[model samples]
Target: MASWDVIVIGSGAGGAPVAERLAAAGMNVLVLERGKRFTKAQFEDRDEIEWCRRDRFVPSILTDPHTRRADEAAKAMPTTDGWISSILGGGTIHMSGFFLRARPEDTKLGSRLKEQGTTGHSAVDWAVPFDDIARYYPTVEDEMGVSGIAGGKLAPLAEHPMANRAEATAKKLGLPIERTPRAILTAARPDDDRAACAYRLVCASYGCPNDARGSMLVTYLRRGEKSGKVTVWTEALVTKLEKAGPDRVSGVRVKRLDNGGVEETVTAGVVVLACGAIESARLLLLSGEGFNPGGNVGKNLWFSLYVDVNAWFPKATMPEVMTGSPFIHRSLMVGGALKADEQKTLGLDRAGMLDLLWQHDNPIHRAERLAIEGGGTLWGRALKERIKQHFTEGRSMLCEGFGESIPHAGAYVDLDPATKDQHGLPVARLTYAHHPRDRKVAEHLAKTGLAILKDMGGQNAFVRVGIGETLILQGGTTRFGDEAKDSVTSPAGLVHGLKNLYVTDGGVLPSSMTAPGTLTIVANALRVAAGIVKQAGAARP
Candidate 1:
């Protein structure tokens, strides 16, 4: 059996940074990825249908074998919205290409809502503050070759600290634009020997071939492999965690997906689950041998309910093709309480509160084009008529909001006793239901989005409330806190039960923050790696 100092599962936004930092620090690290690894040159750009289809990013009954339902009564069958990305580089390889630093207010989750009369909400602050992550933010950016300008009104208000190539155009259009901090490298570094950003706009949902976007294959894994301290096993799905003693986790059992039925074992001193939220929680629940007593191992699920609104302009604005907006335009990013009646009117209960916006690329362009071509066949003609009407009198926009799904006693992820994966372990069962708080946020964000679109020159910016389902950005399970009994992890991301076990993914977040968790995840990993190093040094004789 192969053994290592640390074994990190999953290679997503959270896991990559931690693995790189640990490996670079001279620790033997083994990164086990459930999915196959692909380099930048291997990323497919020709299959727009497969790429645009939500199933491409997530398991659509092939790998995962399960689908989500709106509710228990809604056939209790399968459906998907494709929020998560499974890959060697995780979602960063196929991100929206907009890199944003968390604003101060984004960190101060509780305070921001109270100012907007959003009372009775349970938004909690992050375990670590923005100042704690500030230095690491730039460090990760530099390593990732993040291209951005240095100032913005969103996130940190003080002279924003990044720039992007698209900043000038959005500014001239009088839009709330700033220099977008991107995960793409704008220039070359002396040591890395990687290519730089080519200023191509086709980064969203596609990996950059020029080694620009700082995907994990180029950043963390690259550095780790170079150190010869990190061994990454692709398509190695860890099915179970083996326990050597009451206080120790000895190794993990894996099922090699490529061979289809081979199982192997690898031992490690410490195991860090960096799998995405859902997979991490499911893996924990499946590893029943581990030290989880509270059964809170897979509770506190959270996801942002996305809302999209598109307007067809008299002329093609093609906002979606443009790079991400630099400024977050906080006027629309509000969260808080709402009257019951108000929630019902705006379809808030069904869609969740959403942030508003006036631009975004809708992948349904082909369908929209069919309608614009005057194909008066069945609903086709009506679609074309609507397209024509919008072409002359309408515009395209998208408003989306991430509703906070607070931890609940009922909502959790567990091992499905009924279904098993190819490895004979129980598959993940999600017992999630939408919370009223999220619905309120969705409703409020939707209404606010429509208003913003109007203000931005949309005559009739309507609410195309997204399909309201409890999607999984997935974490808050195995949450970190001050006390072990109250949470699974410490503030520094060490598991409360095991001294060496650390969680460097969304699973360890204190609670949901309004900010995009990618940068925060990387920042926290840096902190955790530093702590591990410090602890190791303190242990030396």
Candidate 2:
């Protein structure tokens, strides 16, 4: 068995920041990642089959299945509905990089909902206020080389027909539109080694070949390795947290995936769990007895509610639609925060954001969707003609709404009674169902999206309200707050009753903000690392 000053589990947006900071603070740090690390050459080839259809980044459901059900009374079935990336940098490697921060009101959602007399939901104010985390946002932005105007500027607009038309229509309708911040570098920075964005259009589901996207693997993990105080072990799965006493975690039990079933327990002065919301809760549940004193370890799980609206425009009237466009760096936050009258009519407490962009250029995805729309009968010349019509005749645009999923007692994760993984441990089972208010809010946003597209002279505009979970943006399993009876962690991200154990991932987020959770996760991890470093200094002899 080996020992270190600090051990961080799961090297993604949450874990990597803390690992780099701790190593920089002169602590001997060890990082454990469950997946293999891929080289730049491996990700250079833009193979849709390997990255999308074959599940290269995600584990197969056959060996590591998670059961899901609509409610407690319903029988759970094996599904991949909530599975995120299992690779070294997690979802950040394949994320679209819409790095928007939570609004100030998002931090105090609990009090807001209370004032509005919203019922049947479990919303709570964050123990750590927005100002506490806002100070660290600049550090993350500078280190990650973010590209956008801080106070919202319109200098770098997407050069697409629909994007330009949509902006004009938004102005006509008196809707506020702003440039979206991305973790991608627009130009090479003098301090960083990563290249600038190539604008290849294969960003969301594929890793960046040029290292332009600010993934944890390319930024913090690289810096940590260069610092010489950090050691990272890939294909190392942490199975359990070893406890020294009733209120403290001493180390972790790791299983080597590359080796022949070799398991070892490594000690550390402090242990931080940053293995995402679902996995973090599962790990806590697996380490039984002394943990879960508050009975809230695996409760209050939530996902960002989404609604996708798409529209088409003919190239004859809109010739620029046929031209290739770069990333559509536009977003609308006009109606995100609903008024009291609107909330009353919608039967909801909160609304969400609208992201405007050009449709994905993946031929296979487009063909599949076309085939489905045509009742799966198009083939040969008909398929080719349809493809040509789609590319030459018109272009499509997407307006997606990412809304808050109000927390409730019914939505949660627990150990599956019968399902076990290849390692013979029980898998996590998700029990969830969208609240009635969620549907109302999504429908409201969809209407707004449809109006924008229609005003922009779009034809065949349609909306699809997502009833299932957005697996990539999940949180709140180990919620942090002021009370141990309700929350699993403290404001500083320490487990409520534990001294040395901490959680710095989405698991500590009390509310699912109206935007993507990646930026907030990284910022909070930095704040938690600072606290851990201060404590270590105070205890030094």
lDDT of 1: 0.61
Please report, in order, the local distance difference test score of every candidate based on alpha carbons.
0.61, 0.84
Candidate 2 lDDT at 15 equals 95
Q: What's the residue-level lDDT of 213 in candidate 2?
A: 87
Give one digit per residue, the lDDT tens place, for model 2 in 302-338. 8988888888888888787767656666788633776
Worst 10 residues of 1 by lDDT: 157-166
Best by lDDT: 2
- Cα lDDT for residue 75, candidate 2: 97
Give model 1 RMSD, 1 decimal.
6.2
Residue-level lDDT of model 1, residues 217-288, one tens digit each, is 788888888889888888888887778877678878887877875889998877887886667777777777
Task: Please estimate how well model 2 matches the true structure, expressed as its whole-model Cα lDDT.
Answer: 0.84
- Model 2 ranges with Cα > 4 A deviation: 151-161, 339-344, 347-349, 374-384, 466-468
TM-score of 2: 0.95
Model 2 residue 488 lDDT score: 93
